[model samples]
Target: MKASDEFQAPGLDLFSFPPLWPGAPYWLTKPTLMAVVGAVLICVLMWAAFAKPKLVPRGLQNIAELGYVFIREHAARPFLGKDADSWMGLLLSIFFLTWIWNLMGVLPFVQLPVSSFLAFPAVIAFSVYVIKIYVGVREQGARDYVGNLIPRGLPKVAYVLLVPLELLQNFVTSLFTHMLRLAANMFAGHLILAFFSAVGFWFLFERPTLLGVPVGVLGVVMAIVMTGFEMFIQFLQAYLFVLLTAMFIGASLNPKH
Candidate 1:
């Protein structure tokens, strides 16, 4: 059989899902359900971890505290400094929720990363964008907030070019990039995993042959390797998203910085 005929790699259709139930709305698809599940899971886990406080933490509390401290120290404190503790709740939610969303891709029977749906990441990014603008305006005042986008010491002639560019970068490009970065990474990672998994299944079970066995083994091995790497990417993207968020809020609060 022809190679193309033997194995058709997964495509964009892999990301598409019908409604979760018959007669359900088009929007009630797998990604939407998984997104909700992820959010609920985070809430439940948080409650389990912190619903009752302990003087010396153990089990879930210990794990949750570690995550809290990690976000506070790594993602928030560096950017927001003294204000970091005030923002820990927001930062922690963003980090864990995003990581869970990305993590859903590897889960059995629920292997769809919610962030792969642009709408999910877009919502978070837009929310942060609004908060950033609001905090900047509130903390720095409207005029100063806008003025802060333009660096202070540029030559007057430089303002002609720098102002528009800085404005665009701060207002438009940053928002879109923030949304796209998370969505694009999860989308591509899911596709890659699907492709490798499909290859292994196709070659091994669907069309087993002496020549195809090695290729199938390679596919399985690569899928395993990619799964590990993808998990790291999932966590890293979550961290980066929260880090950028803290940076945006920090910049708003300290425009000169």
Candidate 2:
């Protein structure tokens, strides 16, 4: 088979198809397209939801209200306490943006989720980390915040080993894990979907013998199952990301627990 013929596979070929730009702006990439589309969609949805400004909320207002309530009550309240009212909008933004980006990866023509990239998640994580540290220092003062790491009643000898571990785990390691958790989940899930989808086509078109048909059917079944699974993971990873952010912020603001 020619190189072109060999390159032809199911999900693999989907990405192999020419990008919107061959040698131009980076924004023209597939993942960027998804991110842009997700952002636009959210903006439109927000506008529709709030444009009328109904008291009872008939259409989009209802959805907007529900989202507001969910983040406020379920996510922010439990983590950030009564003070979370100030951070509600920020938390909501991250929650929905993460969700939309995850869902965007599954869409046709824009199969990549930018959140799957470390740069995107890192940006978010770093921002949140900065906010957390800022609030921590501001609320407790740098002395108190740093002091909180040492257990209130720990022996002087134990401080030698425990202090570094506590600081590393709570302050440093957390940021890395929080960011990578979202990015890795999306990246791995999308890649698996692509692989399975490509293999399915390879089975059907490249090898059409009696054995190939059943295998192709199996591949298709796997692809469908994986896609459904990815959708769930996408939402879950987004929620987890937001939830962790809330938790971290909560810890920084109130680390007594």
Candidate 3:
């Protein structure tokens, strides 16, 4: 078969999978199932690490302790400062869950990242948003919270433009961007992988010819290299998710007036 005849490029449809439960809605599908699995994995890991604390950490506890230190120093401290320790549990969990959710994109059979679906990342972003609003109102009082959102020393005239922008920034845009950041990265990464994988399969297995053999080899190699790159992006996005959450929480605690 001619290359054009045999090879069909993948598209957004590559992300769609028929539901495991035929009647289930589009939102309840493989990506969601993988998220559920990621949560279970996190629970088991935490249990192994801290089910019974030891004065001298070893094995899973050692790893978990190291993770705690990483989250505290890297994710929490820069934003949270004195509040870091108190927020460790929530930040650590969010970091790990987001990390694993992105990881599923590259794992062998489970090649779908839950965060790519938007709804998966929505949970974490929405949770952080609620915490930010609640903490701001509870700690600063409602009027102060609104005042804090407005920049100090601004001319009275500037308040008209700045207030609506800051209000939208704090309330709507923050959460929307947070969710989009994670989902867009994962979605684009997975789609790239699918494209290269499809190319390799088309040239090598579907309609291989001597002329296309080298092209197939190149396609597979590129896919493998991109997969490794995708793994790094996944971890980075996960860390970023936690970092932004901490930043938002910190702002709410001590708003930038």
Candidate 2 residue spans exceeding 4 A from truth: 1-28
- Residue-level lDDT of model 1, residues 114-211, one tens digit each, is 99899999999999999999999999999999987888876899999999999999999999999999999999999999999988998899888999
Cα shift from native, residue 18, model 3 (Å) = 2.5
Give model 1's TM-score versus the native structure.
Answer: 0.97
Clashing pairs in 2: 11-198
- lDDT score for residue 198 of model 1: 88
- Clashing residue pairs in candidate 1 (N, C-alpha, C atoms within 3 angstroms): none
97-179 per-residue lDDT for model 3 (tens digits): 99999999888988888889988899889989999999999999999998898888979999889999999998899999999
**Across residues 45-74, which tens digit of lDDT does each residue of candidate 2 receive?**
888888779878887788778878888887
Clash totals in order? 0, 1, 0
C-alpha lDDT (0 to 100) for residue 97 of candidate 1: 98
Worst 10 residues of 1 by lDDT: 1-10
Each candidate's lDDT (Cα)?
A: 0.93, 0.82, 0.90
Top candidate (lDDT): 1
> TM-score, each model?
0.97, 0.88, 0.94
Worst 10 residues of 3 by lDDT: 1-10
